[model samples]
Target: MLAKRALSIVGGLAVIGWPFAVWLVISYAELHILLPILALCFVLRLCTLRGKTGALSRAFKGLAIAGAVLSVASIWMREAQLLLWYPVVVNGVMLALFGSSLFSSMSIVERLARLHEGNLPPAGVRYTRRVTQVWCVFFIINGSVSLFTCLAGNVHWWTLWNGMISYLLMGLLFACEWLIRIRVKRRYE
Candidate 1:
């Protein structure tokens, strides 16, 4: 579990950092070589099949990995801009996952909360669903922004938004949600 988490962290940083690094000192060719390997190495988990994850989820992951590989192969100096869509693809997949969960018995956030609390209260269930909805909307907006930046044809904006600003906004969202969760828990308790 630790190894998988570590691999994911490293791979995520590499993907998000690649654009900035490319604009700075890293060669685009070097990034192309590293990106696909990182995708397969850290993105594809052999253990994912063992989990209760849906086949559709697994298929989505496979598609992302394949897309990453194809992007690497097709990438050239002029076409390097195509790499900007990587985040959009990622967020789109996440949006699907979260959005689908909303229709299920329990939202994904509720499942994660249950892992810690074991049994969620009525209020908790409602809160989790709201949180899950928030995440779905966030992914949609984030993906849209990613697509817009790419289409705008500015590498600096693409690199800055995808590499730095997006992460910051995500962190802020997570922190704000966590704080809200605490307040909700207190009210329920």
Candidate 2:
């Protein structure tokens, strides 16, 4: 158990650090080398997942599998361009997961909100659904930008956007939603 936990932590860090690693090492290393290392990270993540069949868990598993496949394809085709597409894939998968949840009985945000407040009022449900919709829009915009960066063929720009700017944009969205959530909570109360 301890070993698994340690591996999980390492895998998590490697997955999160991928963009920085690419930025720092791509000059020194070959794309094939980096791609296999990424594949290893995905396999470790897949092995470490909790034994849940919820939509969130399934989404995680799907992401790991997709990441591994992308890495393998990059290696097989001997094309570094495929490596840059990882961020786009990440956004596409996220959009699918969150977008599909909108049609389900509960939006993903509603399910998460319920974890904090056991029974959400009607207004809260509407708020959560709206938040989910916003997330879908964010994913679409982010993914399109990521695709643009990947195709632009400027490695530095790709690294900056994928490694730094995209994260900042996500944080901005999260912060805005949090502030909005406070207002929402007050209104419902």
lDDT of 1 by residue, 146-175 (tens): 999878877788778888888999999999
Off by over 4 Å in 1: 1-9, 21-60, 63-67, 75-78
Candidate 2 lDDT score at position 149: 87
Number of clashing pairs per prediction, in order: 0, 0
Report lDDT (Cα) of residue 113, candidate 1: 85
Q: Report the poorest 10 consecutive residues by lDDT, candidate 2.
A: 23-32
Candidate maximizing lDDT? 2
Clashes of 1: 0
lDDT of candidate model 1 versus the reference: 0.70
**Per-model TM values vs. the true structure:** 0.77, 0.90
| Steric clash pairs (candidate 1) | none
Model 2 lDDT per residue over 15-68, tens place = 678777666544555434677888888888888886858888888888888778
Question: Where is model 1 poorest over a 10-residue stretch in terms of lDDT?
Answer: 41-50
RMSD of each: 3.7, 1.9
